[model samples]
Target: MNTPPGLHLKIAEWMPENGEVVSAYDIAENFGITIRQSRAFLTILEKDNAIETRRGKVMPITCHNSHRRSTRTIKVISIDRDIIAQRRHHYNTYRHCPLKSINGLSRAEKWEFIIRNARRRKK
Candidate 1:
């Protein structure tokens, strides 16, 4: 429904000026979303071409404060307006896509839906 676009815009607005790196954890912390959800949102933004990503070195929260953990994290680049416009138009015309299914669901419900769907697919 309105959540994804609204959230996309919110994330876009919250994005740092171009060239700064943002990890999924940064987004989770800023938006109160689960890390998994943040990652999923990042994936969606990437597909929309609203954000770009690259491997980066960073500290993981679970690690010791002094140690910067090396992992597979990729930093998300800033927002792209033109891509958002194009994606928005395409989504409007094709309402049966994945993003459309969780439209009216609350965050918790959305997670449930995601998990449930994943389980079904694994069957």
Candidate 2:
């Protein structure tokens, strides 16, 4: 597939070795490309099915097919906490429910609460 010069190199640097989804905006800013150019490049990737786009900050990209095994790669930056806080401030007006109750609910209850609430937000 035709790609811009240094695209793969930048991809390698930005993506984890195990390969995880990344944000197009973040990639664009890191590569010094305009948002328009980044969108076009991302379209090219999507046409090839090189990446799976979703309406979120993170989009999953195709990693090497040779490595069929799935690997979980945590993000380098842990800004989700701040982001969630900001989101809460902006959108969440009601009392926040604790993932785990003060009584310390079972693991299933905690997981269920988080999963249910996370799905309440948009992508």
For all candidates, the clash counts are 1, 0
| Residue-level lDDT tens digits of model 1 in 57-97 | 65456756424454234555656779777877787776565
Instruction: Please identify model 1 stretches exceeding 4 Å from their true place.
Output: 1-4, 58-72, 94-123
| TM-score, per-candidate, Cα-based | 0.49, 0.31
- For residue 39, what is the lDDT in candidate 2? 59
**Model 2 per-residue lDDT tens digits across residues 1-123:** 344764733453455542555555556667777655665655544443333333334334465542333322222221134543465467655766665453576889877777876855577
Q: In model 1, how many backbone clashes occur?
A: 1
lDDT of 1: 0.64
